[model samples]
Structure formats: C-alpha cells, structure tokens
Target: MLDLRSFLEVCKKEGELLELRDVDWDVELGTLTELLAEKGGPALLFDKFKDYPEGFRVATDMYTTVKRFALAIDMPPDTNGLEIIKKWRAVDFEPVKPVEVATGPVMENVDEGEDVNLLKFPVPRFHERDGGRYMGTGVAIIIRDPDEGWVNVGVQRVMLHDERTLGLYISPGKHNAIIREKYWSKGESCPVVMDFGPTPLLFLSAASHVAWGISEMEWAGYLAKEPLEVIAGKVTGLPVPANSEIAIEGEYLPPDVESRKEGPLGEWTGYYGGGERSEPVVHVKAVYHRDNPILAGTPPIKPPNYAFAVQVRTTPLLWNELEKAGIRGIRGVWEHGAGGGRMLTIISLKQEYGGHAMRAALTAAGSHAAGYMSKLVIVVDEDIDPTNTNEVLWAVVSRANFEDSVSIIKGCWGTRLDPALPPEKREKGDLTHSVMIINACRPFYWKDRFPPVNRASEELRKKVIEKWVNEIPLLRG
Candidate 1:
C-alpha cells in the first residue's frame, strides 16, 4: 500500500483492525497492546489519548498475524509463512529507486526551527521500564552514505529526550552506524530524516536484513512492483516518504559534541540487554506531518509476541542461501519467534549421505542471514516439520546423540542484545558469542532400520477423515 491509511482499510475489511478510544499513553497503552498480542488479538488504533488532543492517533500490532503481513505485501490474505518466504526469495535483486515529488501530505503541517515540539503527538512510554516515551519504534531512519552517495533506510530505536531532541541507538555494524561514523570521521554531523509512521511495506523493508549498500526504500519498491513517492527534506536533503504520517529532519551530533543516555528499554530479545549508556543525539531541525497524524508504535514485547508476528522476512533468505551453497534436499526452514526470530533456527532436509545433516547445520549456522546473534541451529530429517516446535523437540530427543550431534563454535557474530554474553566480555567491547549446532536427524548408517513413527500414514489419515467427517464433527478441524 502507498500509505498506512490504505493498509488500515484492508485490515478493517479483513476484520483485523480494532480502534480504541480514551487510552492512556503512559504505560496502560503499552500494557494492553502486549496483552492483546500475547493472545493474538487484532491490530489497534488508539485515539483520544488521556492528555493529547483528539484525532492524533497511534497504531500498533500492524503485523501481528500472517494474514495482515501478507496483505501489507500485497499478497493474498490466506498466504502462509513458508509460501510468503518462497515468493520473496524468487524476487529479483535489482533496486527500484523511489520517485521524488515536490510536496506531499507529510508537509501539510510543517513545524520548523523553534516550533518543533515532538510531544505535541502522543508518544507512548511502551514499557514500564523504558527510559522515556519513544517515537521511533515503527520508524524508518533514512541516511545517505557520505562516500557512496547511496541512501539507506533502517529501523532503529529513537527515544524522546526533549521536544526538539531525540536519542538514537543504532547497533554496531549496522549500515546507519557505519554511515554515521563516516561523517564523524570527517568532523561533520550526520544528517538524518526519520519517518515516524511509514507504510507497512516501507516498515517491513526497513526492518529487514537488507544488503549493506542497498536502500530499503528501493527494496520496498522492488517488492511492491511500483516506486514509492518521496520528498526531499528541507533541512537534511534526504528522501522522506511523501505519504508518511509523521517525519522529522535532523542531524546526529558527534559524540564529542553531544550525547544522551539511552536505553534500558525492552528489546526484541525479551531482555534489557543493552543497558543505559550515552549515545548520539538527534537535533531535530524540522517536523513534518499530515493533519491529525497517526504515530505507529511497535514496541518489543516478550517472546512469542514479537514486533513482527512471524519470521516471514528472513527465513527465506537463509533457505535460498543454503540451496545456493550447493546443499541439496532442503524441505523447509523455520526461525522460532521465542528466540527473537534470530537466535534459534530449524532446518529440515532429507539425508543423502553421512555427515549431510551436520554439514547443513554448520552451513546454516554460519550463513549470512542466521549467523548474527544465533544461539542454536537444529537440523531434522524431512519427516519432521521445522515450523512445529513440538515435532522438532521430539526429533531432537529421540534421534540426536548429544555427544556426536552437537557442535559449538565460539566467537561468532553477535550483538549487544544477547543476554547470554558475560558482563566482563561486554565491558571489554567483545560483543561476540557462541553458537550451537545440533543435528537431530537419525544416523544415516542405519536410516532404513530406524523405528517407524507411531502415527497413522498421511494417506490413511486423510481417507479416514474424509470418510468420518459426517459422523465426527471434530475431524474437520
């Protein structure tokens, strides 16, 4: 969709939208959103905040379900997670540049210089222990590479420090962080344009693990098969989504020049792993928004309730990479949401030879998409369903020999959000951690002699269900 309004209309038609009135922005708003998400509730649009003016709204849980996520990407509502991944993997890699416009609805109400008051919008304190009200959870932070001149759109946490200042936290090795350092090395500030409420397509692209030099805006356009409309920022000269709800043009000051204490907020890993620390601050030069702007909120909730409902974006990348690496007989790939969608991965493949399962596990554990912050990578036979945790666990306990099936690799790529990292290592600037690879497939030497499953065969089960449907109502389910 070109704008969030259109996406919300689709969600409403699909019975996925829920509007709430008179909600408090302090902690109640976030608490209720989390509770609903835990129970797989509908997306929320909060209006008439306890203190803020009416018409200024907040939208949360936009991608809390597979159907909603599929609609955002212009896929059929009934599309499943694996199917979406396969479709994404088949798309071309060429970047589709965004089309620039002179002006758009985002500039309908512009607050420049002294009139930049971020608090005018109801920024919610998402979690009880969050440092302050955040405005950049469901955001796209746009910056251009000083040397390459290619634009980059990324999703990073932005906490409100004041009306005209914001605290930005970009993980080390991220494209934005690398670009910001390039500016700092030249003794200059990094110009930035933050879209506080991007369309669902734009947000999905921004939050994805896109290649380093490619722009997320272009990625979104490529996926949508149409160019997104953008306008040059008045202060930063960066491309801002023309139809975005709320946007700000600012510059990230050098750490020596200015910094702010940030974090202790809940992260996607379900932990406050990145404790409070001094980070770069954004000096907002201008604020642009449409009348009655709606700020999107995507606070990180505990495991099983993630910012994105399913691992629909990255799982396909890993699967494609495995095939490209010459590994064969791949049946499926799944990343568990309980591990923040990156920490735990499960791959199911047919065993063609001895050590085949371990090879697949190692390749996946070290793959570009699964390497970062990965704690465990498990490999199962083609018979197991990787998406189902119970089946994967059963295979692990029944087939895997702990001594021979597990391998640990140390000092792999990791992030500060890893809760298992030792405090001393973190203090020493060592963000690396270990990864465990487990091959849960039966030993290939005696594959033919492996015990048969206790359940009925697929053919027999389907025939019985079809024959008993009229007599047994539960069989339909």
Candidate 2:
C-alpha cells in the first residue's frame, strides 16, 4: 500500500518543496504561487489558514519543475523528458486491491449538516477575476459504479458555492460525468467523495487519462511500486486513501441540479471567456479530516506552473506510446506551449515519401484527444526540435513551401473547452471542424545533397562552459 507520508518526505529531500506557516487563501496563497512560479520555485504549504480553524491548512505549487516531477515518480532528480519516457514505457501497471482499516486520520474531525463550513478552510481565490473560491484544483473526486463495484478517481476542479454547496464541472464523456448520468437515469442521487490532500503518485494517477475499466487508485499503486492502502468510504461506498487529509463526502441529485454561472477564470489556453454556464451542484453530506488537516492548492491557470510540468511529463510518454503503436522515424514531438497540451502538436520526422509525414502526423494526432476542436498537427525534418519555437519556426521559414506543405481537413471533432466551436456542438454530437497537418520538411526528392551544419560535441560543450564559467560575468561568483 502507498504511504503518502513517505512520498511527501521524498519530495522534501529532492529540493522540490517549501512549507509556509499561517497563510491565507484569498490573496496570500495566490500571490505567493505567482511569485514562486516566476522564479522556477518549490511547492508551498500553508500550515495555518486565516479563517479556518487552527487545524486547517493548505499546500500549493506541486509539480512546478521537471526535476520535481521526476522526484514525484521516484526518478532521479536530473531525469529529463526522454528518461521519464523510457522509464514509463518499460513499466506496465498492475492493479492494487486496497487494504481496509477500522479508521484513520481523515476521521479525526467530522463536520455534518449546518456545522459543515467550507469557508472555514483555505479555499483560495486563485485569479484576480475569479467569481468564487476554488477548493478542488488539486483534489481527486472518488465515485463508484453502481453495477461494477469499480472505483473511479478523477481530478475535477470544484468551486465552493457556500458552506454546504459546491459547483462541479464534470463535462459530458468524463468518467465521473458518466457515473453521475447513471444515477440521474435511475432517478437516484450519485454518491461521491472528494479527497483534498493526496500523495504525488496518487495525484498523478488520478490526473491520467487511462484506458476504460481501469481503476485509477490501482494505477497509482503500480506507479508507486506498491499497493495503495484504500479504505471504503463511509458515505459513497467507494475506496479512498487512508491517509487522505480531507474527505468531503457528498451526493448529486436531480433536485439539486441548479444552474449557476461558472468560469471566466483564466484557463490553460491563457484566454478568458465571458459569463457563467449552468453545471451540476454538489451538496455536502459529510466532511472528514485529520488532526490539523492540510489543504492542497493548485492555480488552474496558464503556463509556467504546476500544470506545465504535468504537460511536460505527458508529452514524451504520449510520444513513446505512439511509437510503440508502429509509427517510426519520429525525430521529435512537442505539445505546443500555448495549446496547453490540447490544440496543437508538432512532430519532426524522416519522410519516406510525399505524405509519409502526413500519415505519421494523422496517427499521432489521433493517438489521444482526437475529437478536439481544430487539432493542428505540423511535421518537420529531423533537424528541428519541436520544443524550441525558434527551431520549429526556422524549419517553417527556410524549408516549408506554403503550397506543398499545408493541408486542411474540415469537420473533425471538438471539445467543450474549445471556445471557437459553438456551445451546442461542444456538448452534443460529433465536433466537426477543420484540421490541418503541415509538412514542413524539405522536399528530399528535389534536393541533390543535404546541407551541412557545424555542431559541438557533448564533452566539448561541457568543457567550454567550464573554461569560460569564471570569465562569464553571469556565471562568475
């Protein structure tokens, strides 16, 4: 079984963490995170919150760096994307059946009915323009299938509407949304438990988009190289981590399905869409927490944050999975910085023929999240590094012939998050939209000889850095 205590200890040792005492969620936590992310910083923990009872607390900025992500998965501190990909590819996950205990820290403090106050905790006002305090950015909401006895753990952002109410955004097609629909179909309420504080491996497992019929908690156990000790939920009849700091047990009923305005908050796309939309409202039935409970914080915003680290970890793994499916000569693959891991993917490949790159691009693009709005897939030559915008643009500028390189396919698929598509198309039916796969590689058949370039050896580059380190003012002490 996974021990969250041990995992957090490892994070501290790996130089990926920070602990702050007596912090507030409204302005202090958000301000600290913004400042820390700018400096390539560590995770922050709020030991004491402003309005919350003395036992209430919070932590934020987890997985802010690649080094931190490596540490989270028990990899070496210096591990890069390639190394992470190699390790993940070699590993196959086995399901872990949870061990139950009589009771644990989560039950230390319980608040029910009118006494249950969400505002008592450090639910942060993340963006300046956010309408309400968010308590679920880093939390995992647990639900069980009525027929299968299978448990689903997913990372869904929840907005704190009041002391006993929550605004949950479970878009259609998500596992939780599907489960909720099942309950609604039967004219019954869906039971759910939301875990606020969790171990890094468990958090990652919950965040991952795994295959159907797979239990996320079991996947987490495999990732941790151990079985996750999960206990049955008191309210939801679901399995939950024994060491979870806070567990808010609740239900979603058709009667409680009130339409409230959500969002206009900064999305990962770095764009702000206007107004509130109708979504399911959650009514809290019970609240559980450990002694001196610690709250977890995550800013659901644009790049250069914890979200960026998750995308960075995902890119190489996704590339590895695609290659394993038989596509070859994949020189480089990049999930574009602005897209936030959805809209665009850039690939560099060795083309066998005219449409070789296009074929590979199509396969890779559809590898995951294919039905999203306007999936832009661009393919370049081996000389280009897709991660580097400058290098990618250079290939497009020097080699890409607009007439030969560009191709567009209309009426593909789209998602609810895509602002360009109509709201109705996002929620129902296939999101038919135009898609493009641009071949930016040089036309090899026409060129007589390849261009030569001067490059430095790894050893020589290291030596040069060492030699000039003292002479370089930035490098000098």
Candidate 3:
C-alpha cells in the first residue's frame, strides 16, 4: 500500500516473491521470467546479475497472478478478475489530491547531464528475438498537458537507445502522445519524467483510461484511499512518486532533430504486430533512484497471464459506462480472461424489449472507455454467464440466427498492435477496424417457444457437490 518496495515486502511475507541470485542479464534473466510465468510462478526478484552489481536488481511478474494483482490494490488474495474490477468500480474517489513531499527514496541518488547512465540498471532482453535490452516495460511515463496543466501517465514500452537516450512507443490515441503533440506544436521539446518501479498500482492507474483531464495520480489516490505522495521533479517539473525505485527525467526531442528505432518486443496482445519503426527520443537530462535500485521489468512475454491485471480495468469500466448511459436491464459484463482482457468481451442482459441484445452489443462496441480494439463483442441473455466462454458460445450457437445476429462495423477504433491488421494500413496509421458484434440472446418473437436449458440448475449442482465432496477434489472451491 505504501510503495512498490512495500508491495514487494508484502509479497515476500506472503511467499509470492521468488528470489534468484547472480543470473545472466543478456537473455537469461528474461528467459527465466518467461519460463516461470508460463508455469504460473511467483513474483521474481533477481539480485546480483552476471554483469551488474549486487544492489542493481530486477523484478518481474508483479501482477502475473490474481493473488499478486489483488495485493497490488490491497484486495483479498483470492479475489478473482471480475471481483477485483467490480470492487474497484465501487470505490468512492472524491478528489483525494496528491500531497507534496520534501524528499523520498527515489531521489536518494541523483545524476545530471552526462553523468546519467541508463545502463547502470539491469535492462533485460526479454525474448529471444528482441531487438535489444529494453528499459521501458513496467514503467510509468509522466508528462503534464502543456495547455490544460493536468498530468497524464501511461505505461508504454520503452527501448534503451543509448547511454543518454531512450525511445518509447506511445500508441496513437494515448494521452501522452496527445500531450507531447501539444508541446511539439509550440516547437519546444516536451519535458518528461520516466517513473520506474514505484508501485504496481501506480503503473495500473497510470495505464488506465480514467476520464479525460483527470490525472492518474488522483485515481491512484482513489485506489489507495489516501492522498498519493508526489514531489516536484528536479528537471521536468512534473510530479514524480515520492517512493519510486527509479526516475529518468528527460526532454522528448523533436523528431526532426533526433529519432530512435524501436520495436519487435511482444506486446500485451501476445504478439509482435507493429515490428520495428522510428520513434521519438527522450534525451536523458537527469536520473534519480534509491541506493541499489530494483528495476521493475514487466515486459509482455508470452500469451495469457501478463495481461490479467491489465484487462481487469476494462470490465468495470464498460459496466459503469453502460449504467451511466441510462441503459437498463444490464445484468453483468465480462472481458474474456484468456483473451488478455482486451479483444473479446461479453455482456449479459435481461431482455426488456425487442432489439435489446443488439442495442447492448452496439453500445459496448462503440464505447470509448472499453471498446477500442475489441475484436468480438457478444451479447447474451442474463441466464448465460458472460465470464464463462462455454456458456456464452453455447448460447451463441444455440440461440443466434447466424446471418441476422452478426454485425460488423468497419473503421471502428482499433489498436495498432492488432496482429490481424494489414501491414500497409498499419504503416499508414489506420488504427480503425471492423468489430463483429454478435447478439446471442434468444429472439424476442419466440417468447415462450424458446428451448429450455438442458443443464442442471446451480442449486442442484451445489447439492451434488455437497453430497460428493469426498470424491471430487475439483469441487472443493
């Protein structure tokens, strides 16, 4: 609850911290993380890398599991994905505003100008085909809107360009990109502070879409139920988390003067869609860190687990938007967990009128909070569990008239990282794409003629589980 360091301490106490000593940094450090993550391993804290000193360490898999993710937001360890987001949506965030601090752990050691060397930290080559060791994953890039004066924080993939420079991949619609353009339009270099490994919640809140103009720090305060501690950055003048593990303050040089080649790192979509390209460069002006800093490495490794916590935000966000839109009979909403909580979403509703299911589907697909990049949006009756793919699919195949139910709206907001996108269109910055909205709910005209579910009821299932408790191990949960 205090900082990333405090969260790691809690993880250590709960036996969620996996300490690995004296590992190789080149590819070995990241390889181990990927292998352990695939096996559903614990949070990794690597100390004494082959080329780095004992104090310079790296950590991975911070939110790889539900237990770890719940800890990130101070929730119960066993809280599932849907529950986590729902609880977050229920919090009363009444502008807890950031409290300024004199000094903290992140500023313990400071380097300015040519003295700043990013290579001091243990940057890892996360995958076998990676272009180089990256310093951007699991990091929060802090920038304030030049006009609005409100801050924007985004967790973007950063490439370590050199000893004094770094490159970042800011998606087209992200606030950071918009804010940077505002600075660039004035023909001035945009100052930024790269906040690294302060807190997992800090990263989560920063990366989320809280409403426009509201700072992510305010949202973090909402999650912590207390004002977040921030300090004036030494160079950038932006607010940096008081207890962050590392801070890299720099100016985003105009692309005309300098640019850095970035990419090929696997993104949260579990694929490398964009590949390599030239991106804006952040010339390092100052560096700050705690003594023997732990660089948090949250690179998107293989499929599935990396995006669980990332996707949780979307579930509640979409649900709340629907309620705000005055759409009634909304029973539940779920982002298919295995889809990394991004592409596939399902909405369950009690059909109150004709076209209700299609209406819900269209609303979800067009949502700004959670609709972007959604590949398939399925709407089902309240009887179906949106979180359960098997139930949703059964409803789809059984209830839907294939030709009438499927609706594809072309040029809808999409992501550049979508692997299915054509290379030429991606290069041209055409992020919009078609989304398939499927209404799997039973036809309103059928009324009482609709076929009843053949499966046993939940009461009967619970009764069976209670009666056969001794014989069925899987039913214990």
TM-score of 2: 0.85
lDDT of each: 0.88, 0.71, 0.83
Q: Which of the predicted structures, 1 or 3, would earn the higher lDDT when compared with the native?
A: 1
Candidate no. 3 TM-score:
0.94
TM-score on alpha carbons, each prediction = 0.94, 0.85, 0.94
Each candidate structure's count of clashing pairs: 0, 8, 0
Q: Candidate 1 residues 204-226, lDDT tens each? A: 88887777788889888888888
Write one digit per residue (lDDT tens) for candidate 2, span 320-417: 66676676788877777566665677888777676677777777655643223336887888878888888888877777788877888776654455
**Evaluated with lDDT, which candidate comes out highest?**
1
Whole-structure CA lDDT of model 2: 0.71
Ordering by lDDT? 1, 3, 2
Candidate 1 yields a Cα-based lDDT of 0.88
RMSD of each: 2.1, 4.2, 2.3
**Which should have the higher lDDT, number 1 or number 2?**
1
In model 3, residue pairs whose N, Cα or C atoms come closer than 3 Å (at least 3 residues apart or on different chains), thus clashing, are none
270-378 per-residue lDDT for model 3 (tens digits): 8887688788899999988999898888888655766677577778778877877767888888888666776788999999899887877888887856776888999
